[model samples]
Target chain A: MVRVTGVADETPTVRTIRFEDPGMAAALPGQFAMVWVPGGGELPMSVMAGDPGGAAFTVRRHGPASTALYGVDRGDLIGVRGPYGNTFDVREGRLLLAGGGTGMVPMMRLAMRVADPSRVVILMGARTAPEVIFERAAAALGEVVISTDDGSRGEEGTAVDAARRLLGSGRFSAAYVCGPEPMMAGIVAEARSRGVFVQASIERPMKCGVGICGSCCMGDRLVCSDGTVFDGDRLAATGEFGAIYRDKAGIARRY
Target chain B: MGLATRVAGIDLAGPAMLASGILGISMDVFRRLLDSGAGAVVSKSLSAEPREGYPNPTMAEAAGGWLNAVGLSNPGAPNFANMMRGAPGVPVVVSLVGSDPDEFVSMARLFEGLEVPAFELNLSCPHVEKVGLEVGDDPELVSRIVRSLKGAGVRVIAKVGLGSSDYLGTVRAAEDAGADAVTAINTVRAMSIDVHSGRPVLSNGFGGLSGPPIRPIAVRCVREITSRHEIPVIGCGGVSCWEDAAEFLLAGASAVQVGTAAGGNPGIFAEINSGISSYMERRGYSEISEVRRAA
Candidate 1:
């Protein structure tokens, strides 16, 4: 069980809930944990930055599960069951990280792991200025570029648009993206054309955050087991990557 | 010396199948499951057309089991058949779910030229409407659907679960309709509510309960089926360990399907198979049939 140490409202709908979890802090970036609220429900939450003293999760209010997760009081107990799925594999090359909305949660963790900030470029986007998350935190790690759909923040337009511009600069070896499927699909196409590898953390309805429930699958791959983090080639290979995904009912829904 | 077993004329490398709905979709995943030590792999229940199951909150933890309402999601039978065209020499049992006899027959017919070893008629999905338990509960519908599939010359295994009707009656209907075998106990109808929000935890509001909590009931169902009927029974429910597999076998299940257990580790198949092998050796049994025969 992890104790809530702090909760910071990152945006109107998103909040960063901090906890004291020594074990979770050791989990690699891009992995997630299954948090169980006593009466709410167990759901997968991406693990954010953590230290030996504390760990955190960036949760966006979406449903009862998230609401229950967000309703925690400081010091309330939450059951955690992972650090599941593959983590971002850092390599010896310039890195480009692109994220949008709550998708930026894992990206923030990735940004912190890079030893050389000069080799990193962070592209973030949201619907409006207030919705933008982890701007300062991301900026502290690397060069942060912000975009909002309403033109209320730096460079109006989708984050993929700014990512395309960054890719055109021709300085990165790979790109890591987490966001809406359509936006990630766009960024993946742009990155692939630029001869850069891309790793995307795709979200699916997860049951057993460990990989058994088969709830989190993209065609043949279980997002929880095979990955919530998929490489560009893997993303391209899965027919459902940007096209469709299975919901809680195991029915395919268009992205 | 060999862990191989046959159920309703379908050969399996082991007695454990990658249960329907978990990593049962792709040809690559099927191959991987087979390689990971599954005797056979059942596909996600395929419908006539693509279905976009319930919105988020599809699964939840309920004590010792999982409650899920993944509304029989699949890319339609025609699309899945195309995927099966690339089958990699593994024993693949295609699971088909539909509301009508024609829907089930048409879906089964699509695999006429494919390498599908058998078709498991999904007549027992508890949470979905129209299809699953709804269709399964109707004896006439179950019989007609099974008869039609049998007439198609497709080997059929009827998957049954506890619903409003007597689940055994559904099994009997399938057997009378010429179903080659029976898989006992799909997830039992169940639900969970978020006390804090005062709302159903699952977006679908209801789902099938699976995992360890359902294991004893599954074993009882398998035992009951074996006791009353002379058909091959595949036991499924909360089978997470080797002991559960052994218990199911002692209760008369010819084979068992692992679902929720695989959620935590796909490698559970390998582990279960390994554990079963060790048990058999220690007990001086060479064939799984020996345990079944003794039971």
Candidate 2:
């Protein structure tokens, strides 16, 4: 169990719940925690670690689990079953992070901790203006770009638009991504086309939080243990990226 | 000699089968496990209808290994059948769980066209209610379920665990009903309480314990079952290393199933297979059958 150190409402619908966990300090971006929200339940969440933020999971308030987690405040205790899942292979180079929805959480952490903040470019996507989260915080870390589906923010189209602009311009060492399958798929393709190495974090309905239950299956890979962060090569080999995902019942569905 | 073995009349390349509900349940993962060195693999128990399953905290690290009460969450037999379409011939066993003989038999029939080697009747799930241990405790029900599946020409293996009633009777019922073989144990009924919050660790209040802690009890069950009946036995529960797998064989099991322990190191199958080969050399045994109980 860990203590909730602070809570900040990133947006109207999104909130960042912070915790004081020394163990999580070592967790790289895209790694996760099976955070048990006291009386509510446990869910796999990407742990966002930064210097000032310490460690936290950003909740978007969608389901019963997220709703309960979004309602948490300071000093409350919750159980953590991670630092689970693999981490991103961020090296010293010009890094690109493209994320949409709650996927931006980990990218923000990447921006904050990358080897060279000056060489980092972070792109965040949301549906509308108010839905745009962590804009103020992300700007503090590196070069920030925002895109919204309805054109309510910085750029109209999607994060793919901003990503295309950056990757098309010059050489990028690697790209780290998270968010909706289609969007991540687009960004991954764009990054790869430009000869930039790419890694993507994926979400699946997980039961045991540990890799054993076989719940968080994404195509052929167990998203919990094998990776929430998968390289472009791994994703391309399975042909599951931008194609299919599994639900809680182990039912395969097209993304 | 090679690490080749057979259980329930099904030829398995190795003797170690991946226990139900490890890593994700997909044809892709199954092929990976087989290629990785597992003899065969068991799917997580599927039911008549899709179950959403229990909330979080469904599993916890306990004294021996993992304690999990996943509430039998599955994609249902129909969906699983869809996934199994055009499946390659691997020694994959589909585990079925339900309330009655009809549910079990009907679910088994859904895989009729698939190359599924066998159906493992999950009569031993310790945490669920009205099924699993509940069904096993009722010898008549066990007999009917196994008999109905066997009557359909579908190979059946009844998995049994310690329950309120005599678990041996459950195995006897399966044997008398013509079950192909029996997996001798399931996770032991167990729980962990969080004194900090004064609540149970698992959301289900209690769960089945699997891993090293249950190895001794599992070996004892396999020994007792083999001693009493001529039916083949597949020992499961708490088998982490080849020594544990060999111990099960020495206790009279024809094969072994590894759970909890394999979650972290899937390569354990190859290690155990290698260990078993060297063990055969050390004992001068030629096959899995020769690694039997000592007087």
Candidate 3:
């Protein structure tokens, strides 16, 4: 069981919950844990770098499990298992990270892990001003550019739009992304046009965080094992990457 | 010869299959496993309606195996049947679970156009209520389910497990009702508790255990079922290596299914197939049937 040591509001509905877990801390930037709320259900949360030798998960207050998790504060205990799935493969030189809402968690963590922090450029996306989270934390890691859909933040468009504009202006060694499927697909396409190496962390309805359950499947890849983070070339090859995904019921749904 | 063999009326390129609940349901995954040398693949058990299954802590590793209470989450028959559209000859066995005989037969018929080799009647799932072992425990219900499916012209394989009632009786009922084959043993009923938390590890409190720990029990059940009835047996549980596969075959299982182990090694099918071929050559056995005869 992991005890919450601290909680901080990232946005109106999002909170960053901190806990000390050696395995989770050691996990790669894109991996996640299956956090089991005491009496509630378990949900997968992306692993984040925490202060004083611990790990953290950023939760957006929605759904029963996430709401229960969002309300947890200091000393609250929750069952956590994993550090499961693949991670972001760090590359040298300039790196571009783009994400929105809670999807920014892994991108922010990846920014911190890069060898040359100053070379990391992040395009943080949100719907409005208050929803743009961790701007200072991201800036401290490198360069942070915020994009809000309503034009209340840094840029007056989606991260994909901001990224597309930036792609022509500069040469990034690689691009890392996380967000809604369409958003990631857009950034990946932009990155591909510029011949940039890209990696994207995908979110699937996961039952078993382990590889056995087919709930997290995308195309032929079991997201829980093959990757929560997949390379640009790999993603581009799988038609299901941005097109079709399975819900908890195992019914295919288009993004 | 090669690792090729036959289970009931179905032809298997190898004797190792991808067990249900382990990356099952996708015809794409079945094709991948088939390409990787698996004999066949079983889809996760499906009911009349889709099930979301139990929440997390559904699986816990303990006591030399995995304890799981996934609650048989699956897309209902219609959705899965649609997924199988135009993808024939994948050699997948559809596994069905429900509260009664009519439910099983109705589900089997949904895949009529898919050429699904058989429906593996899941009468042994250990965690769920009303169905699974609860229904399997009643010999009358077992007969009715198998008979109904057979009457609908659906080839069936009865998967038996250790429940409160005699497993032998379950096998007998399935055989008498015209089951094509029997998969001896589902996961063994088991649980694990966290000492510090003073609570059960699995959400269901208790779940079914699979992996190295249950191999002997599964082997014993297979030997017993094969000896008592004419039903061919497909042994499941704790089959991680070639020797385990060979052991099951020698004990009279026509095919072996791997679950827990394959989660880590997707190449297990190819590994087991090669190992079995080596075992047959080393033992001077030309046929899989010859190995059973030697036993």
TM-score of each candidate structure, all chains considered together:
0.80, 0.96, 0.96
Error of 2 at B160 (Å): 0.3
Model 3 CA deviation exceeding 4 Å by range: A50-52
- The order by descending DockQ is 2, 3, 1
Q: Which candidate achieves the best DockQ against the true structure?
A: 2
Which lDDT tens digits does candidate 1 get at residues A1-255?
677888888877888889977678877788888887766766888887656767888888888889988788887877777778888878678898998888887888888888578988889888899998888778788988899899999999988888999899998899999998899999998998888988998887776576655666687788888888888888888777889876554545687
Which residue pairs clash in candidate 3? none
Better of 1 and 3 by lDDT: 3
Candidate 1's displacement at residue A46, Å, is: 3.3
lDDT values, one for every candidate:
0.83, 0.84, 0.86
Off by over 4 Å in 2: A51-53, B293-295
Q: What TM-score would you report for chain A in candidate 1?
A: 0.96
Docking class of 1: acceptable
- Return whichever of 1 and 3 wins on DockQ: 3
DockQ pick, better of 2 and 3: 2
Shift of residue A99 alpha carbon in model 1, Å = 3.1
Q: Each model's DockQ?
A: 0.32, 0.63, 0.58
Predicted candidate 2 versus true structure: per-residue lDDT over B126-195, tens digit per residue:
9888999999999999999888888899889999999999999999999999999999899999989887
Candidate achieving higher lDDT, 1 or 2: 2
